[model samples]
Target: MRRRDFLRTAAVFVSGASVSLSALEFLDPGKVLAAHPQLRWAFLVDTHKCVGCGFCVKACKIENDIPLDANVTRTWVERYVIKKNGETVMDCPKGALDGYTSKLLDQGKSGKVLVPDKEVAQAFFVPKLCNHCELPACVQVCPVGATYQTADGAVLVDRQWCIGCGYCIMGCPYGVRFFHPVERVADKCTFCYHRISKGGNTACAQACPFGARRIGNLRDPDDPVAKTVLNQRVGVLRDEYGTKPHVFYLGLNKEVR
Candidate 1:
């Protein structure tokens, strides 16, 4: 109750915490990564099947209890339009939350005919979320040891331990990590860790009306998703970065970053 007693207790608690963490510091994270168990998870996103409804985005925010802010997005959708002029433009205004509609445009007098939106060489919707890399850069760059992966292959941030230094955000090559709007801590999609761990579907996967997203366990011999991944040319984003992400995409093109 006294000031001196309170100070002494605080110092003891801090010292104990330091000692506790020092023990864990020697544990190799490479050991965490190198264990090639027969049980790992994966995700598939089919761009052709997604309608840009934004339901997945909405469901992700609601299920994760993330507030709606202009600057913050845990999941979002982008519309890619490749013009005939060999120019590509992508847009995701408001995360396509209201869904996409016809956009009015003016005709230009550049002597060459302008391509209409519907007549673009290519157009599709890509719903973006955490790639959940096998060798997550965010986890590697986390200075305070607040980010790590689980045994079943999900990357997560420890909210209580995170110091909000933004190192993980910078380390992510996929642009999936962000500083939470209210908490100001590193935040990202955990592939709905709580539900997935309990053998349930992710919010986005369940909310998707068209069945464009599929969650799969590579270890499962009878899973249809595993068969699909094996039969199709599944793609990973930024493969050159060597993140070795668990999430794969169907119909992914060079137009997307």
Candidate 2:
């Protein structure tokens, strides 16, 4: 069998391992923490290669059954354009579902966008989703024991148990969580839990044409992510909050949030 197919089969067996720790630090020093950190699956996003195509976003919606609304999103790409003067303008038109050229603009009284010209400093796309933090704030704030972190480092929710309090919504600093428009429950990315557990890649990663996104077991030294995290210049969002997120980025501009 192929490596990924084999890994998915392995994951199915490992899924039986109970992830009983509370949100983050609840696991003892050695319990849920893998003896080899690389054994756990991790996600990576190469911002430099993402073309704001919205393919990943659209694939995620179809794979996970997320209802599409202008405001609700499981994953979205932000297009950032920085001017020479250091002023930055950003927008994500319909989550860039149709790609990021000729994006929809909000024309106010002037009926024209006042954005900087294309001859600006730089531009790039940064995709956003639940970071599946090692110490997730969303799990900590869920009053109903609905939001949870899996043993394999995925942050998820028990939709049936979620009370729609939106507390987790407020607790997530990354702005990745939102109240589901139709379901009325708190919703966010789950790292494609269903497929990954069966050795399949998350839909977003599978759909990325440029190979900008990926998931891999950090423990396998041969896994590309294993070396990339150690050698590449990578960063995660909101490190100041001490989230210790598993998701990482490459070519992250200082202007991105």
What candidate 1 gets wrong by more than 4 Å, as runs, is: 1-34, 104-115
Each prediction's whole-model lDDT (CA) = 0.83, 0.83
lDDT of 1 by residue, 122-219 (tens): 87899888988889999999888899998878899999999999989989998888888777688999889899889899999999999988788877
After TM-score superposition, the amount by which residue 25's alpha carbon in candidate 2 deviates from its true location, in angstroms, is: 18
Instruction: Quote each prediction's TM-score.
Output: 0.80, 0.82
| Residues 106-151 of candidate 2: C-alpha lDDT, one tens digit per residue | 3334453555466578878899888899889989988889999877
Question: Against the true structure, what is every candidate's RMSD?
Answer: 15.1, 14.6
Enumerate residue pairs that collide in model 2.
Answer: 8-199, 38-218, 38-219, 39-219
